[model samples]
Structures are given as C-alpha cells and as structure tokens.
Target: MATFNLKTVAALLFLILSGCATYQTKVNDARNAIASENPEQAVALLKPLAEEESRDQLVYLLDYATALQQARKFKESAQAYQKAAQIAEVQDYYSVSKITASLVLTEEMAQYKGDDYEKVLINAMNAVNYLEMGNLDEALVEVKQLNLKLYKYRTEAKKNYEQNPYAYYLGAMIWEAQRSFDDAYIAYKNVYDIDPNYGPIKADLLRSARLAQRPDELSKWQKQFGESAPSVDLKNSGEVVLIFEQGWGPRKESRPENRRFPQLKPVYARTQRAKLEVANQSATTNEIFSVERVAIKTLNDDYARLVGSRVAGIGAKAVLADQVRQKNELLGAVAWIALNATDRADVRQWSTLPESFQIARMTLKPGKYKVKAIGLDAYGSESGEQMPEREIEVRAGKKVFVSWRSVR
Candidate 1:
C-alpha cells in the first residue's frame, strides 16, 4: 500500500507540473494579443480550449469572456461568464481541510474555485456588459446577484478580509439609473460604512439624499463633508460617467520556497497605477480623478495560507522520498524528481483585469462629444503614443456611460 501510494502521488505530481507548462505555452500568444488591443485575436486563440466546459478551465473561460466583451459581443460574453461561473461552483466541495491533496500536489490540481473577489466580479462585469447593450432589466439582475454574493462573502470572510466597496457602489449606480433613489441611498450608505475614505461615495451619498428628499440625511452628510449639497447641474445637460480601467491586473509568478531544494510557490505581481487624463473633444474640458488602489482581491492572504500548507506537504514527501531512495535508488530518484517538478505555482488569474478601477463624471449638454483617456506612466509621461479616444453621444435627462481599458 505504501509503495503504491508513493507511486501514485509521484505520477499525479508530474502531471500537474507538466500541465502548468503546457497551459502557459498555449496561452502566451493569446495574452500578447490582448495587450495589443486585439481581443478578437485572443478570442480566436482561446475559444478552442474553452469550448469544453467539462474541462473546468475557469481561467480560460474568463479570458475568453473578457475578450468577447471587449470586442462588443455582449450576449456571447455573458454566456461565457455563465459557463465559467458554473465550473467555479464545483469548488464548494473542496473545504479548507479537503485541500490536502492540492497542497501535496499543486494548487492547479485543485478545482478552480474563484476567489471571493473574482466571484463577485464575474457578476459585476456581466452587469457592465448588459448595461452597455441598453438591457437595463438584465443589468439590474446582475447587480443584485453581485450584492448577494458580496453579502455572503462578507459573512464568510476572515477578520483580515473586508467586503468590496466597489461592488456596493456599482449597485448604487444601477439603482440611481432606475430612479430608485431610496435603494440607491441605502447602497451608497453601505459603501460609506465599508470605506468612509472613498471620495466618490461621499458625493454619491449627498446626491442620493437630495434626490430622495431626506432632509435629515442631507444635513448629516453635509456636516460630515464640511460643505453644502454639491449640485449635479443636471437641469440643462446629461451626465457622462466615464469609467477607465487602467492597466493589466496582477499576474501569478512562482518563486523558490527554500534555497536548497527550492520548492516553487506562487505569488502575485500587482501592476502599477497609470496616470490617466480624461478630456472632452468639443470644449477640451477635462476632469482629473485620481485612482484609488483598492484591494479587490486578497491574493497575499490566500497565497500565504496555500504556500504554508504546500511547504509542509513538500517537506514530508521529501523525507519519504529520501527513505525510499535508500531502500531502492531508482525509485527514490524518480520520487524526488517528481516532487520537485510538482512544486509549481498556481499561475491562473484574470490577467486582463485592471489593477485598480477609476471613475470620472462630466455634465454635458445632450450632444455628441469625443472623449479621450490619455494614459500616462508613473513618471507622468505619455505611456501610449496613440492615446485611446472615443466619440460619445450624450442625451438630456439621461446618463451616458463610457468605458476605456488601457492594459499596457
């Protein structure tokens, strides 16, 4: 039984490690295409791997869905996200204690249950897609799902983890659009409660109070903000809410655990903030909103716990492999090699995601205007030679939405 178990473990480890290498090679081309603003190319590259939902490649599905959305294929994007969510649902069976096999092998070997943030964001992105297509009812449904997921995660999160304020903020925006001022007020208030320092929520709370005709709430917010009710100036013009998704989000990399055997463990490399400039082409008026670095996903915490377990498992296996080697040199050699090979990091992630989300709003007379998001690097220098600019038509009494993704 001992010999059989060791051999089985060795074989499983070898397969898991080899799988990561194969997957990276397969996706490298697709990743580059996305960076070049050619999501169509990425979709073509990733579609074949994503066709089989039973394979449970959530990462592949996520990339495919993002590319489809970027290419303006909203319906197809939503469908792909739905399939990815289904695969992630299977992760519920793998309780923390049940992850022993994963620790002994590789995190990639475990079912790809999305992190809490990723789960909520799946709904959030779908909501954006639905809204962009002018499907208000469908967008509302997605926002409601996002809130419910956040509530559940909040209840289950460890003490160190906090609920996402952006999720609540987005829900509030949806309610505001629906003219459900009461619901919007409540959602905005929730955002305030989670992150009082978030500047945008302060303005939103005040606006919701005024719209809801809650005098007491209005007074409370005014005192909190140390100012009067900031006017929206929507009487003559419609509002354009410009959301800029700046740069490529963090990606997973493997690092050696120890100096000797050097068991590889996964870590995340977060992208730096891009200095963005928002401008209107007609008047060339611009409003600069600084991007806040929100911890949308707690990768550090997740990696710490995972790496700790992996280290213990690797150490135990190393001892056993040494014992087996003394008894039979060939078997021990094979076992040792397999153990090292399987010490691969879990590199799967939603790479197209932005490092941080930024928002800017402008009140413009319902007319056509060209809006531009000029990307700048850390040194306040132009990052993209050809800036990303889009033409938008703003209408009176309605909010126009524009989004730009600058994944440099």
Candidate 2:
C-alpha cells in the first residue's frame, strides 16, 4: 500500500511540473513570433493550445484572439473572444463544492475563472472587432452586453468604484456614431463623473452636450476647461481618430517561499511613450500630440484584492498537512514537503494585451493624411522602430478610424 501511494504521488508531481514546462515553452515561442511581427505564425502556434480540452484554455484563448486581431482577422478574433467570454460566464455559476479540491491541489490544477476585468475587456474587444468589420449592429449588441456585464459586477461588488471609464467611453462613441446623442451624452457623462480630467472625455462630453442641446452642461464644462479642452469642428468637417495602444501588459509568475506555497505575482515592464506626428498628404497640415493614456482597469488592484482569498485557502492547506504529519511522521513530512515544492499558483495571463489604450482625435478636411508612431524609453530616447507610416482617407461628413499598436 505504501509503495503504491508513493508511486501515485510521484506521478502526480511529475505530471504537474512537466505539463507547466511544456505549456510555458509554447507560450514563449508564440511571444517570440509576435515580437517578430509575424502574427499569423503566432496564431498558428497558439491555436492548438487554446483548445477547449486544454488546462490553460482561458489564457491561450485570449492570446489566440489577440494574434488574430493583429493579423486583421477581426471576425475570427471576435469569435475566439466570444468563446472565452462564454467560458467565463459559465464559470460564474460554478459550485462552491470545488473548494474541496484545494485541500490537496493548488489553484494551478483548477479551471480558470477569469478575472472580472478580463471578462469585461473581452466584450469590449469583441465590440471593437465588430466595428472594425463594419458591423455596427453587432458592435452595438456587444456594447450592450458589456454594459450588462459591468452593471452585474457593480451590483455584486456593492460599490460604484469598479465602473470602467474606458468601456463607458467606447459606449459613448458607438452611440454618437449612431446619432443617439442622448445616450451618448449619458455615457460620456458617466466617464466624466469617473475621471473629469481624461483628455478625450472632455471633448466627447462637449460634443454630446452640444448635440443634445444641453446648454447648461456645455457652459459648465466650457467654463471648467477653458481653452485646454480638446474640441473639433463637427459641422461641415470630417475627422480621423487614432486609437493607440502601448507596450505589452502585465504577465504572471510565481514567487516561491520557504515551507509555504508559491504566490502568483503580476510583473509589469518599464515602458515610455513615443512622440507621434500626423500630417496631411493632400496639404501641409501637421499636428503633434503627446501620448496620454489612463488606466481603466488596474491589474495590481485586482491582484491585491485576490490575495486575501488565496491566503485563507493556503493557510487551511498548511494546517491540514501539519495534522497529517502528526499521524505518520515520515509519510506526512514527505507529503508536506512535496506539496510545498510542487503546489504553485496559476500564473497565466493575456500576455499580448496593451498596458494602456489612448486616443488621438483630429478634425480634418476630406482628404488623405499620413501618420507615424515611434517607440521611446523612459529617458526619452528612441527605440529605432517606427510603426509603418499609415495613409488614411477621410470622407465628407463621415468619421475615419485607425488603430496602431506598439509592443516593444
């Protein structure tokens, strides 16, 4: 009996360690492909690992969806993210009985119930993808779904602090595009309520207020911001908006401790914004804007809140292990030591996500324009890699949208 038990434990440990090693190698390889600007290769490499049967399904699905979006496969990207969102919703109702497994197994062995912020962002990405594909109806549906999810979260948290300003900003854009000025005004007001100093929010608030004919609100904002508020000539003019995303987001890794289970920590890299320049190809209209992006959902805050629950579970596991050791010294000691070494926290994340999302909205005549974005470090030194200069055409009385990502 002792021999069989020992062998079982050995097999379980080997399986856990080997599986993590194998998955981590694949993750690194896909990251390399993305760094090389070969999103097609990244998608191919991540697809197999993103299967429903995989242990890290949620993490890989997010990676695969991002790669697809980078490749401009917006429809496919939306579908992939939709799958991840479905999985997240299903896990919401997962039974409390699953806690029993924590006595013997770490969080790494359980199915991933995605972080709340991740769930909301998944829908936001889907909405953006639909808009990119020129499906306004689908995009509106996704925006509504995002609102529903946000409301659900707010209700569950029993506080209003968890509201997402970016999501509200996006909702305002969709509504404004549809000429639903009242709805757009409400959404923009929500953003302003959350962050009054946000660059684009002030401009959006002004536009919506003007369209909705709320002179009182418009006067209030105009008085508050004066000439510093971002504005555009909406009458008899077209606009080009650039939604820029900066370097890679946070990643997850385990920090091991003596005689205690490893803890998962989010690792963020140091990155700086690059100077961006825009010019008109048809005429001499040059513009420059400094990079300014705010955190809509802070991962550090999420991790800080999660630590309490994790500590409780881990503490209970330690107590149980010590009790087992009291009964059989040698076996219990071996088991306790083994769990200490092998039981690690799950360290998977949406590795390709951007650290921040920013907007550069400009009003221009109906003509072609060229824009370039460069990467910079904290010391204001250039990284020598400039995003390919993009040429965009603006139509009369219509909006032009462009997006660029820098992950250095």
- Which candidate's TM-score is highest? 2
- Consecutive 10-residue window with the lowest summed lDDT within model 2: 282-291
TM-score of 1: 0.80
Quantify all predictions' global Cα lDDT against the true fold.
0.66, 0.66
What lDDT tens digits, residue by residue, belong to model 2 across residues 101-158? 5435556555667666677778767776886766767887887887788787678765
Backbone clash numbers for all candidates listed:
0, 0
RMSD of 2: 4.6
Which pairs clash in the backbone of model 1? none
